[model samples]
Every structure is written in C-alpha cells, then in structure tokens.
Target: MNTSILFQNVKLGPFELKNRIVLPPLTRSRSTQPGNIPNDLMATYYGQRSGAGFMVTEGTQIEPRGQGYAWTPGIYSPEQIAGWKKVTETVHKEGGVIFAQLWHVGRVSHTTLQPGGGAPVAPSAIQAKAVKVFIETGPGQGTLADPSVPRELTTAEVKELVQLYAQAARNALEAGFDGVEIHCANGYLVNQFISAHSNKRTDEYGGSLANRLRFLREIVEAVSAVVGNDRLGVRFAPLFESTTEERVYLGLVEEDPHQTYISAIKILEEVGIAYLSLAEADWENAPDLPEMFRKAVREAFSGRILYAGKYTVEKGVRMVELGYADLIAFGRPFIANPDLPQRIANNWPLNQVDPSSMYGGTEKGYIDYPRYAG
Candidate 1:
C-alpha cells in the first residue's frame, strides 16, 4: 500500500515520530477536582487517540499560580504526577509519543483561578480584553468571567517563573512524558512578554523585540536544561491579520509576522529544540500563515515544524508535499474521533464533535468518542 505523507516516519530532533500526524494540545478540563489532577477518564481519552504520530497533553499549569482555568491538569504536585503516570503509561503501551504543554495564562485569568484570590501576573499590569476564563461554580458546571487586572512580575519573580517552567519540565519527565512543549502563544504569559501592546515594562524583559523575547529565551533555556534541548518544543500563535473581532483574543497582529516569527524561530534554532509548533487562527475565513512566513520558519529552524488550526487531511498532505510543514495536528477532529489518523487513512467517516462538551465534561464526550468501525 502506498503510504500517505501523514503516515510517514519523520525525524523531529533526537526522536523520530512513527507518523506525521499529531494530536495537538486541547483543553478538555476533565481532570479530577481538589488538585486538578489527571484521572482515569483523562488517561482513557489520551489512550484512545494514541494512533496519532504524536500527542501533546492539554495546556497544563506549571504551578498553582500558573493556572487560569478551573479543572485543567497541573504538573507541579506529586498527585498530579501520579495521575499523569496512568495517562503516559497507557499511551506508551499503544506505542504513542506524547509531550506535555506547559502553560501559564498570565493576565487572562480571573481572581478565582488565582491562589489566595490574588491578581494574575504579567510582564505589565494590564487587563486582558475580550477573553473569558472558566471558573468552576459547581460540579459539572462552570462559568466564564472577565479576567482580573494583572500585576507586573518583578525581576526576581520573573526569574522564579523561569525556574517554575524548568521544574515543570522535570515533573513532565517524572510523569512519563517523552518531551515538553512551552506554551508561548495565545496571549499567555510568554505571549504577553512578546507583544508590545501587552508588555509595557521598562525592565530588561521588555522594550525592544530582543528585550521582549528575553522571558521566552530564559524559560526555554531553563526548560531545555531539564528536558534536554532535543526533547523540548515551543508553540507560537502568529496571526498576520484578524478579519473580525475574534482576532483580538490572541493580541494585536504584528506588523511583520514573518520577521517576528523568523526571529523567534531563530532563538529556537540557537537553543536546538526538537520542533516548533505554529498555531494559526482557527476561525472561519481565518487566513493561513503566509507562504513567506512558512519558508522563513523552515529556513530559520533546522528541526521539524508542526502546524495546527482547522487543518484538513488534504491540506496537511499538501503542506507536507510542499515542504512547508513537517507535521499536521488535528484538534476538533481528534476530539470526536479517537481513531482520526486511521479514519483518514482508510477514508472512514469521522464523528462530529459536540461543542457544548468541549470545556468541562464527564465520560460522555471525553472518552466515549467511538473508533471507526471499518
């Protein structure tokens, strides 16, 4: 049988993926309560989708202070590590490679999600606009609330956050993950530092583009130190333009996204990380990353590159054929079809994802997604 590019083996740094299809980081918020630890349900969910070439766990908080949404898993505590052990073991048994996405919401968090009811932390003291954080109001019920005004992190505190990221990498290793991916996109803490509109600090962590990239550089360095550069990955959401108000969620579009991302990928090149994950706008009519930006990414980074954002099988194969993207991640499709890669390969029908069960839910939409019968 002729193999599709999506099912072909590809080298990503020191590791070689069995295929080119990836299950991108997705927030299901199904972790156990009290500690927001991964549970059996979460493990089953990941295990069922182990057919993908690689899988990245949902945005996991590096520390308690890193949390912004209720019920999302964390990598800090011992219990959380134990919980993730079950998940990683199951996926590994199925011959799956998985990475943990270390995340911090920064100013995009509400006081309820903060420790001791404190404000969220950011490079500058600014309130995020047009974003809502989910808070658990009761069992099986959550509501979105406006984020609190964040306080600027002091220089010492910024260094501490770097340590936190490194520690999370260690925890990821303990939890049995093959690697770790730094969440530097989607208006999160790292994104805040990268954006001129969000980072208004006068310190070394802000100002020029180099200064703005300092935080990301520090975190990447620290994390790479723990997980090894060859096992480290970075994710960035570079939007060129927003056709409507939804574009505001990620932050102001960079004047030259090509140059901005090329420079960022250059940092990854120097760091010698495994791969770079670029998340494009997923909304309807959203533009794909420009051809120039795609070439710039390939030229700047020597390692593999993964792209996600409403990707279809044909588009993914086209990107791979064009040498633009090494791997393609399917998000919503994987949510409803645990056997997405196999389904695509055999031309089988896919299950439709229920948007209502996306955020926080039980076994219904979490692990009950049936595999292809054919």
Candidate 2:
C-alpha cells in the first residue's frame, strides 16, 4: 500500500498525535435516559474507535435548553461529567487523545427537549426548516419532528449563555478531557447568530457583520478562559450553496460565504485557539469551496487547520501535502470502522454503515462493527 501524509505524526497544539487521522464529533443517540447521561455502552462505543490519533466526543449539550435531540449526552450536570470521565479514561487507556465538543442546538431544538416546555431560544424567533429534531416520545423511543418556533434570547440571556459555555468547559476538564471544541458550526446557536437570515435582532448580537460575530467572540473568550486557548478548538460549518441535499438545514450560506467565514476564522486567529475545524458541505454535487477561500484561510489562521466533509484518504493526504489542512477527520467511516486508522494505514477494507441502525439503536450498529482481519 502506498503511504500518505495522513499516516505521519503531527503536532496538534500541545498533544502529539500518532497520525493525522481524526474522528470528528458524531452524534449517536445511545446515552441512557432520565437525564441524557453518558453510560457504559456509550463508553464502550467511543473506546472501540480510539485508534484515531485524535477523537472528539459526540456533540454534548452545554445545558438543558441547549439540547436539540433526544438521548445525546450533556456536560453541565454532575452525573453527566462523571459519565464522560469513563469515556475519556477509556480513550486515554487506548493511547488516544479526545476532546469534548461543547454544543448548543439553539433554535434547532423542540419544546420537549427544553426546560419546562419553553420555546427553544435563538438570536431571533425564526423557526428552522428542512431538518428534523429527535424528541423522545416514550421509554427508549424517539421521533423526528419539525422544530418549533423559537423565542429570541434577550441580551441578558445571551450573556448568561456565554457564562454557561465557560462552565461547560470547566465540566469538560473535570471529565478529564484533554481539550474542548466550541460547536459554532452547522446552523446551530452560534451559527444562528452569525447568519443574517436567522438573526433579525437589532442588538449587538445581530445586524452588521461585526455585530453578528460578537456572540462567537464572547464564547471564545469564556471557553478559552477556562480551558486555556491552547486546549480549545472551534468548529464552523461553512456552506456556500443551498442545493438540495439530505441534510439541508446545515447550510447557513450567505451572499459571500468566503467573506463570512474568513471573518469568522479571523476571530479564531485572534483568540489563538489550538485548531480551527472547518466543515465543508457534504451534499452531493455541492459546490466545492473555492481555492481562493482555502488560500485566505491559510493566511488568516496561524494555528493548525482541520477540514472534514466526506474527505477521502487520497484527498486528505493531498490537502495536507498542499498545506491547505493540517489534519483530516473521518466521520461516517469511523462509525462503522472502529480501527479506522489501522485500516487506513494498511489500505484494508472498510465497512459500510447500516443507515437503518444509525441512531437510537443498541450495540448493533454502534459497537458491533468488526475490525479489519487483514
């Protein structure tokens, strides 16, 4: 098998990865209920895929109102923090570095997942479309339902949310995670504030580009203060097109996506975080990000840059070799291939994910994927 740059050791902030292969944060609704807490089963699932040089936990809600889906784990509660400790300890035992992805779904949530059945909050009261949020119906059961209209968060509430982000970072550290990643991507809360289409607020959090970026800036400051900028990473989903795709809701495309994301990247640069993760659009036939934007990103951010979006091994190696990205993340592939880095290094056969058993399932699709026999 031909060797690739992806197989080489790389320095990601303070940690030395065995290779550049990364497992991006993937949401698997397998957490135990009653509190949406991480459990032994979830630990087993993450531990099985610890072969990656760096692993990011599934998107963990920072608070109850931040939850958009059913059965995902949280980082705010005492039990949730303890539950996550098992995952981090297990990954460490396997000689892998893992980071907790701090997430807040914002308007992507439903009242069923909110506190006291209140409306999910966003920068504005706009309702999200073209996507479904998983809401628990009964014991161990969930359904994809349309998102409800969200209430615009007041300025005071926004500040409190920033503090909550800092607290989440503290909880992540308490859980023994090596680092944390602020989920500022994929049309979530931070993205909601950034996109002009969703944010109609006239306050400092909305309107002009500078105003739109305030929420993200505040979050970076808060999280970095607790986790230290060197141990923090921020992820952004920058989609340049709105072409119909399986998951259309992720694209918070703007008139000038290049400018929009460059500005966002510049903030990460100013904050001096460990790495910047840019998630490209995965929709079929989606327009590839222009070479110009990629060049701009390279110049704007001095720290390591990671890109994930249906990346192939050949593509990842080429990107790294060309200096476009320092690391690559394998999402769906990691789900079905526990020993993904080993398989990639040896060019072994990969398993196809069973879409039917992807979410809200037992160990069937989550932990039953066999490693390569070769």
Candidate 3:
C-alpha cells in the first residue's frame, strides 16, 4: 500500500480536506453538569486532534428530549452555544476544520435521561436490547442501565422533529461549525425509525423500506435547507454480519443491508450532499464488509465516502488504494494519539489508551496522552 496516499489533500465539497484522514465523532460524556454544556476541557480535547483533515464533534443533542446519555452536550441552549463557540474557535486556531454531528438516541435510553422522566420516544413502543444507557445517579457520577420502553411519536411530533433538526443546523453554524453531519446510524433515533425490528408504526413513516426511510429523508432535507447541501453530510452504520455471528447492539444487521444503505446513499446523492460516512461494524471477529457491496457503494453514491471501524495504517491505506473509500477515520487510535496523523506519516511510536479512563473522566485520558517521544 502507498502510505503517501493517505496524506494527500482532496476536495470534499466546498472545503478541501488537508488529507484523506478524518476524525470521526466520538462520544465522551464530559460536559458540565446541571446544564449539558461544552467546556474548556472538551475544547482542549478536540483542539489536540486538529491534525485531522476534517473532524466531527461528539454527538451533540439537538434538543432536551434528544439526549440519552448523561453529560453529553446539547445544542439548544444559549449556554451550550457559547460553550461550543470556544471549541470551534480553538480548532480553527489550530488550522483544522470541524463539523457538528447532530444526534438523538431515541429508544436506546432510560426514562431517567428523558425529559420529565418520561419514557423515551421511538417509531414504536419498543425497548432496545443488549445495550445499556448511561444515567446520572449523582453529582459527577453515572451508571449503566437497561433501556426503557419508548412511546410512539404522533405524526405531528415527527413533523416537529424535522423542524428541530433544521434548528440544530442553524445552532451548529451559530456555534461556528464549518458544517454538520446527521447521525442516522448506530441504532439511534434515525436508525430505530429505519430498522424493521425497531419500528412497527403503521403510519406513512413506516411499513415499506421507502416508508421507513421517510423520517431520514425529511431530516436530511430539513437540515440541508439550513446548512445547504454543500455543507451537509450523513453517517450510516451498515452492519453486515454472517449468519454465524450474534446480532450486535449498535449495528443491527439488516437482512438486505446492501439495498437498505445503497438506497439511503442514493437519496443523499440526489440531494447533492458533501459526503457519506459508512461506519463498518467494529466488533471483534465481525465479518469484513463484502467487496461487491463496497464496489456498489462507490458506483451508487456520487459524493465522497468515508469509512471507519478498526482501521490500522496498513489497512486504511489499502482501502483507499483499492478504490473503496476516499477517507479513513481513526477512532480509538486518535483517542490515544492526538498527533496520530503525524505519527503515522513518520512511523513513530504510539501511546496505548487507558481503558479504565476512556469514558466520562477528567483530562487524564482525554488530553493527557502525549505525542510520540522524540
């Protein structure tokens, strides 16, 4: 594999990517409490990873009812806006471009995380299995618990959610983000609506594949109107597992994933969006995404395609060389090595991440990971 290919600059919509390396959105629940607001610490963490060609922020809740995890930042409040302003400014000062990932966890949440302690909302009154939601038990303390059953949304509320997504796009721009990515993957809100197992709604928003994708189309269209198609992107985690493997929590393997996701990408292509991020199933022994499916995605989608899973420098360069993906995202590796791109380019030693301090911690594991020793 030609390692240099990963460092080459490429055009990504209106803005040019400094390299083919991307920093995908990672959820580190460290925002200030009482009000889920971004802080200086969060800004420091992102600023450290500015070497990426493009970076997407952690899942930022679009509204109060959208939050599913404790201490994850929201985009609806004035304080949240100001707090994120610091982050955008810091990243920009480091010569990096950043995008806000708009997110809603849907039924994969406990009632404690919902507004008024209400049951989380979904396309149907179903509970997500195998995954646990983080709930704040006390000051600076949280616990993992089973998700609660959700309440089905009325047609009117679904319409309002479309408006909410648009407003969140406006908020992201107000907070100084270069663009926004709709988080329609990982069995979250949009994914729940799209999945046949999670959604049993008999309304226009469910039933057929086209009907199931209606909510996603509406949010993408609504968000595009605000951010413009050139500045918008969508992320879809299409899990393709063999029959031998057990179904995972975040990525529910679809019976016809190729059709499901290619159709989804076609919608984005018609809208003329900036890029599409396809997150591969990242679990141990997860079957590799089929080459035929990859080739089909490249042909079906017109925009740039970015991929992330458990990618190494060699594997990433090979993917780009094989003409499958345009950009590669380093998730956990970036977590441990802030100057990850530089280290890879120079073949430098990397730091190992502290598993214990990975989620909801102080700056210990966040920004304290040093660069390659000289």
What lDDT does model 3 reach? 0.90
Model 2 C-alpha lDDT per residue in residues 1-374, reported as the tens digit of each score: 24467878888889999988899999998988888889999889889988888888889999999999989899999999999999988899989899999999999999989999999999999899888898999887889999989999999999999999999999999999999999998889999999998999998898999999999999998899998999999998877766767265454778888888899889989999999998887766666778898999999999989999888888888888889999999999999999998888888989999998888878899999999886
- Tell me the whole-model lDDT of each prediction, alpha carbons only: 0.89, 0.90, 0.90
Error of 3 at 59 (Å): 0.8
Task: Look at candidate 1 and tell me the lDDT of residue 55.
Answer: 93
Residue by residue across 1-374, what tens digits does model 3's lDDT show? Answer: 57899999988878888899999999999899889999999999999999999999999999888888888999999999999999999999999999999999888888898888999988999888767888998887889899898999998999999999999999999999999999999889999988898888999999999999999999999999999998999999887774443334454667898999888888888888999998877777677889998999999888888999888889899999888989999999999999999998998888987888777979989989998879
Instruction: State the TM-score for model 2.
Output: 0.98
Residue 280 alpha-carbon offset, candidate 1, angstroms: 0.7
Instruction: Give the clashing pairs for model 3.
Output: none
Model 1 ranges with Cα > 4 A deviation: 1-3
lDDT (tens digit, per residue) of candidate 1 on 1-374: 23377888888766678899999999989899899999999888999999988999999999987888899999999999999999999999999999999999888898888889999998999998877788889887888888899999999999999999999999999999999999999889999998888989899998899998998999999999998998999999998885665534456567676777788889999999999999988888787778987888888888889999999888888888889899999999999999888898888988999998898878988888888776
Q: Poorest 10 consecutive residues of model 1 by lDDT?
A: 243-252
Model 2 RMSD vs true structure: 1.2
- Residue 138 of model 1, lDDT score: 88
